[model samples]
Target: RYWPRFPRPKTVLTVKEVPTVDAAFVLQSVAGLAAKAALRGGNRDMVWYPIGHPAYLRWHEEMLRQTRANEQVLPDVWAVVEHFRRAGIVKGYVLFRKDAGDRRLHQRGAYDPSANVATVLAARLGAVMVSEDIEHEARARGLQRLADARGLTEEQCYEHWAAQCSDSVLALVDPRVPHCRAEAIALDAFVLATHGPLLERALARIRPDSPILGWGAGDEFQLTEPVSRWALWQSATNWCLNLPVLSTEQVGSTFPASSIRARQRSLWDLTWEDGVHYTSFLMTDGDNVQWLMGDFQFGAQRSWWNSPVRGKFPMGWGACLADLAQLCPYALRNLIRTASPRDDRVLMGGGYYYPDLFGKSRNSLEPLRLHARRIRGYLRLTGTSLLHMNAAKWDSPEAIRAYTVFAEEIPELQAILMVQYAPYTAGKGRVLWVRRRDGTELPVISARFAIWAHSPFPDDGPPAEIAAKLNAEPRLAEPATSDAENRSQPAEVPGFSWVTVHCWSWFKNAPDDAAAGAEETDQATAAASGAKRGLEPVAWCVRRLDPHVRVVTPTELALLMNLRLRPEQTLRRAVAELHLRLRTAQPARRSAARGFLDKAREALVKRNYRQAFLAGKNAARVLGVMP
Candidate 1:
């Protein structure tokens, strides 16, 4: 699935005055318009670059100067009227108006209706949709071209398009409905109802078994702007790939890709030693490409990526490589090009389509295999092996078994950096092994701690606090001990501990911090108005750690854990322990354990050790042997 030669834009059009209501709508429509024009021109013609974000603008300028020096540059570009006009693609405009009584509806989940309607119309009619507030601005900025070319008034042109779309516009979800009391539930229902059919229709147009893009559903709280921006990118991506966009929600039950592929190559060559607490830090939430293209690209995250201390330590960036390859190949290539060797590694973020919500049934392994294939394909393309995955239910053995498929299918996939958000979950700070057919083990290491706004661990707190917490964790402090009562067996070979530091929150400058030094403080303030936070906090935490702890890249951490752990013996012992527990377990627990045990034995017979371990582990959980 790697592009031998990525598509490059012949011209770059900069959209200024961004993040405003009017510009948001224009930004939403321009990419699709450019895409339609590209179809006529037989090449990727232009890149619709949005400005007004100082950090992003600076990054964009640097990237362009570095990558596409010879490409034509057009500054202060707007409306994209000429592209659409030349292509004769814009039939008319779909006018969306905010409710008079609820002017702020667009900011809330209610705006999803208009957003979905615009996406459907953009795909079907080559139509441009804009909010009523931007109608005048759009016209004066060249949207009037359609009306002038047709010798029709703007009102008449709008009416003509409106008549064609009478059945296309979706009605807003009524929050007053009895079952829609909660905002989250209402938003889910709204997306399912409004965007569901449109997405289904689009999917039907593509081959069922072909790989489709999983562009996530936009942010629900602020639906209007984000969805509008996504709609533009979605349209362009749809045209470029000739494939439909599936939300993580939509693909949870049944992912439809026939196979996923990436280039396979060695990323790094490193050796590991024992008697050290090996820690790897991973930056999280890169599964969402929209976030990558929006905030992560042009927002405060730019500063984080550009931090002077970035390459000084081993940091893993969780990135959606498949999406980047399709939407922003240049940025993806540049990111890999600029990465520090042996220190910075771009791990596959969320496994192609972010399988947190994927079904855990034995049958789901088919989709899981396809998903891993996609991740493996991209890993080969990017020359990396570690996969960082988020699980909705990481505590269950069935979930772990599903994940084992990645290690089973892709030998290149050395380890999985697993994270779960559920409260009181017991999987953290432990390493689960999947024994390969050749008797080798692949390690699945759970996050020891996380830096996230909503996480229980230190989020915005001082680095010293997190350092203290890490030093106190029993798993990191000493070798594992046998737990006979709980059936938690000791590591067959000990002396090494793996700690993964997961970060979901961006760094922000603290104004009161005298420790940042005057020069660093001034730089932060100037770069992003004090909104940006660099990797200094991570560096600080590592520096404050106990002397025995050694920071390593995720790749090295996996290698060390694999070398020390005895996968076959550990899994066999776990299964035997679960059988013993079943004797005294309650009837309900015994019944569940019996079923999972049967599956485990079956998988073992087939030499599917990964699945067997997961099934056995699940059985143990049922009998209260494993957490």
Candidate 2:
């Protein structure tokens, strides 16, 4: 009935259709969409959602009341009713006796159990009763199951027990023809499912054994294996091998280990030789790339041999392509190139009702709009830079994955994700690679590696620590005879205070500042006409955070360039690079003062109205010309 105007909206985009029966739910659904869209700046120019807000609830309720009574309802009223049914606004449903001749519906004047007057005239009223037909459908299917399970007893069983309790159970019969699982679950109505995906999700929410009456899987499924558990990698995959087709065990690659190992070792040699050169060589490995490309698009997996005539796994198909793209590199694009619809696999096998997780296709490789969180155990680990290998075979893809899982699955290294990836091979089968993927590089795996250290403000001289008087343990409450909580001392170390350092807090080099100062100097030179103001911009060092800003104090500026931890600036990891850079250059202040004074001296000597301007700035100080 409505739409969100957004994303430049070159073409109208839609989220299928809204549940039309439940009007209450429609509001929540719309609000939910708006809340998420509000977080991003992308749709600012477009309308987020529609009009007709729920703030005016009374008008809607009256409209619903008028709709039930009216023989001919307006489209707006009908639409609202349908939205309510879909969104699940009705709190209760028809729960009538099933013994009646017709169970399809209640009489038009059926008693409203909810009315204050129903019980008041209970004995006097002879109103008809009706129930939503969800359980009734289940009884029909359950009879079918009983027939298959016991044989020769299906019809008789229904004839005896089902009829004897037909009124008791028929009222609970399955499938409300007017509505379905969406309405049932949304309304939290207890109803039976006939072996479907809705049943899976519903059973997951309301405990699987919550007296959930459903037709047993008579024809839908059967398995010889009873229970499953992972023998390795997972405790369940081992038993899952009992699946009709392939399982994780069957999902592994058959690429020869020796060949893969040789390729990896060759890459390792390249890293040892020259990183840039190796990169250049791999880019030209046309033969190796072409072989991988053909295999990528043409494998036994492409044919229906090992492949499924019908497939499953919501993330598997896209995962396969993403994996191939990563493992074989550019071959993914080539694999798609020279490929046809006939080359793809057909998808099938249950979970079709799960429109979101499985999408609306049996065998579609639609782009998955998914956000997969790679907890360290799950990420592909590559020792890119500063990565120290711990007794594991370096550059072995399998070994890296194993170690990453071990680090994450094991107790001690929990919450940590170790990544491994196939490194780029370069220059005649050699590898030049970063030792370990640094924190900056960790983003490739969509992760952040935060390190913790125990230090007592080495640069701050412990003055700040004494002033705060904090400790790891929370402060103890003073005794009744002692001071009150107000005067109680805080812990010696406060809670875990995490400080992130980006780089070395060094001043910008004088040359860089001079380059920046070029324009201003040009302007000043222009103002001076043709005279040599000798106003050359001096070189000075500054840290990234406004590093070129003038520094007035020696002590404040000294700690910045020493590579030593600065009192205020947070920079530790890159201190090594910063130290090398700063130790090689003069102090920023010294160079700055010299340049300013030199220009002033030249101006004053030339009588360029600068003798007064030379008040305190000395050119000697700037140029390092003492005395």
Candidate 3:
């Protein structure tokens, strides 16, 4: 059963401008309007005319013309009608027109299932359908003959009849009418069914060039999948791209999938939502945890490591540390070293785009100050007091500037230390410098034993091959030059004949644990040969290569570079620092701390740099600072 009730506006307000209609906005407006309308008249009836109806086409054209003429009328009239229908305030009916050509066309429905579902929901909410009267249709035909006599074609005459019929019925609608709860539910259903395609279309149209403009995405122009035929057209002419932005034409491949990066992205979102309370956990692939300690991943890792934590004991605050196999002692040391700052705050991990540091001009110092404040906030939340600022990517000038700013802004903060990307490659574990915008320069000292994060020794050939490679390269010696010359001139990284034997991370067809163990054995053998020839190890091997091979913590290495100390002197200095920290320590721990310091001094006297470093490192751990 169907009924109709029309409430004509007392005065029709003319629309001055016509803007492009957005379905999402229309849905929201309908929600707001329905709530109001339902409150105004509890049992009021309204009519919902489908946008696909021939009546709507006429109204659309007229609306456009009127808007251009500056004559006011209801804009998005179809949206208003649909909302009223779904709101259960309207009677749903097809108005009859005598001259309307091909009556079957009017009965044809919307192609989208979601659109059909919407109508069903509206009908259930108290809408009724009705057809036109036959007697009234006969009178309409008499007027159609006049339209035909006025030089109108058959189709034009029929359209005019249909348009007039729709106008007579719809003109009764008040633009401000709203709906009820039933209508709101119907809109939600429609949105759920249609959101997928809408979101994808929105993502596709986004301009990848500028991130600022990307924030304002989600334009309403739309088309869906399962097309009978498709083509890209310009002015009714088809065109094809010789080169596509993506190599694959598959749409599925273009959309991002779940991965480590996706996890990191979600964590970032969580951080923004409630950074104070949320603790994020990241499970990443690749065994390059050592590389993670390097400069490459610093910016990304900062968001996690520096995120604010909550609770009285720092239990619920900050992120958790995890890895595939058991984490290495050196890796843990590095993690602690990287996380530590003077007041025990979080690290900024440098700015968003660190490489552009030198090129971009900063008018104010607020950005740097903000990052520093974030660091301080993290420290305060975590209940910790100090973080060791070691393991840095010293290559970027901007990163150096950020570090310099941190030192300047924070009162209790000490100067930031930096390490080389790969010490074995070039720059010879020397101290580097960066020039600030004000022409002031800052020192960035390198860590000793520029240990290979991944295996540096090659396995393709014999163990002697490692020595042959290092022997071919220039020796690792400090450059005897002025600070100005060092800053102005770029040093070329000496070429080594050795091959990159072990890639730390996993691959699709990577070897299993057993095979990996054997590979490590071969790499260690090669490393030992290189050590015999004065080639230093950047990182620790799974097994010790030689008793005399020196190993030092990143901080100790940096200290050595700054002081220009030889291996024995560096070891002795580390031993002295440990003793100094334990001088005023409690009696309970004094004995244990003093024992390690004494052992370190004895090893230094024995001229065994490797043993001395280990003893010194242990003493530093006992005293609670690696410096």
Candidate 4:
């Protein structure tokens, strides 16, 4: 069990106000470092809760109430520093500038060498990294204690720490060059390139068998911009190896307990007869721990779980259970405890690190296998069976077959939600199947439609346009005549459309305003609203959809598709269960189950999927296999 005994905090230090984005970023980095250091020092006596915006203070209070933990307010960032000092955890401070000048310029954005260097020095010496620019503001905000306990000025302290770390190996990267950042991140965990010593030190501190920390990017950074957050650098300094920071927010965090407990949700719960047009809406990017701890939950962009439209429709959230368990178990527990049964469904995202480039060796399957074993453990811990995955090479049959390693290792995994940045490149409506040693098949369901803010596809158009396209699509509106026809079509399973909506995409206006030339305004409004913009685009799309279309969860869509495509396998599982249950049943029930089983087998041969499913359900009921 990865269920850690969380620190029962006697004192919850709340940072009620932060001066700026830069200040908030520095404070959070310091807080994470302080928390880790305090825990390591055998003083699990406090929890650092920072609320950058005053509007989100209620969320902080609500979290405290749920945990039954009382709070002590730290009025400013300096006060937070003072508290850590008073606890005898922090010894000194290392200061750096947010802007590193021309030394770290990139075409996309500049990387801050100062920030990266500061992180290394802070960890090596027991100190907090603060932005040099914030000192004057901090002093103005009532900084009575100057230079920490070491009695050294910010520059003097940085120089002292730098001198000690002068011999440390550094992997200098040029962000302006294409694929350089990606290469650096891919090698950060294993090799000592680009702050490798810190990772090595961090790995040495943890158990040899412990799951590797896949500390992804920060809330402020993008794939092309590595300097904004320096999340990986911070993680490395804290003794946690950083995984590929690319698409960090695109992955997920924390699986809900209910998802695991209800893993046996009947495949027959959703049937082929449910509707003519079937669709499952999944929100992407739950893997970033900092994003979840920052804006996604409590900042201006807090429209996800707290949305007013939540529970109004079925939706799946992609999360990384392993990362949450290690970094912040309380947040994970809070997510599970507050999840809505009607709307909130958790699906594993990216599987520890991004599966596309997890291991050091690209040609070897051993790394993939090792990662799968760890993923299997996380799946069991989180009570999740479905996974949302992405691959660098997904077009070829060989590329698709690589995922069988996951299915082979994680026997309980029900299905995989395959998403790529460019869906058209992988072929439209692709569904790949692989058979295991025991003859069971695994499905890799490719996303047919996507709604992302920065998507480059024509299909990822406005909500109204996409909805209209769906309504006009004949394959989704009409049922397949034969299994072969269903298998051959670009729509994959007839009447079902697997839609992946990026978490960042949302609508600001009502459906009417969205259609009448407000599309541009929607994007602008979404950006402006920050955490306040809920899932209005989803509701907008739902309203515009044809009456024949039925919205369902990812689980429902996967099970329904499996039943439609593999009627024989579906019936076999039900029949086998019925036979086992019948051993203890009365003679009348056994006879009745036999009759239903026969009908199911006959209907399967005739390709009467609805009849076969109904017969299987009846057999399960007769044998007490289902209620």
How displaced is residue 250 in candidate 1, in Å? 27
Candidate 1: TM-score?
A: 0.61
The TM-score ranking, best first, is 4, 1, 3, 2
- When 2 and 3 are scored with lDDT, the better candidate is 3
Q: Per-residue alpha-carbon lDDT of model 1 for 257-303, expressed as tens digits?
A: 21222222221123333345666777665565545544554454544
Question: Candidate 1: minimum summed lDDT over ten consecutive residues — where?
Answer: 178-187
Cα lDDT for residue 152, model 1? Answer: 28
lDDT of 4 by residue, 451-569 (tens): 55545665564566556656654454365544342122345556766777767665545445444335434565557564223365777777887777777888777777667666677
Q: Could you list the CA RMSD of all candidates, in the order they appear?
A: 14.4, 28.2, 23.4, 8.3
TM-score comparison, 2 vs 3, better candidate: 3
**In candidate 3, residue 347 scores what lDDT?**
26
Which scores higher on TM-score, 3 or 4?
4
Regions of candidate 4 where Cα sits further than 4 Å from its true position = 1-38, 47-49, 52-88, 98-108, 130-264, 293-302, 325-346, 350-354, 360-362, 423-426, 453-456, 475-492, 506-522, 525-534, 582-609, 622-627
In angstroms, how far off is 254's CA in candidate 1? 33
Q: Best candidate per lDDT, number?
A: 4
Q: What residue pairs clash in candidate 1, if any at all?
A: 261-377, 262-377, 262-378, 263-380, 263-381, 264-380, 507-533
Indicate whether candidate 2 or candidate 4 has the larger TM-score: 4
Query: Candidate 3: minimum summed lDDT over ten consecutive residues — where?
Result: 233-242
Candidate 3 stretches with Cα past 4 Å from truth are 1-352, 355-362, 376-400, 410-429, 433-443, 446-548, 562-627
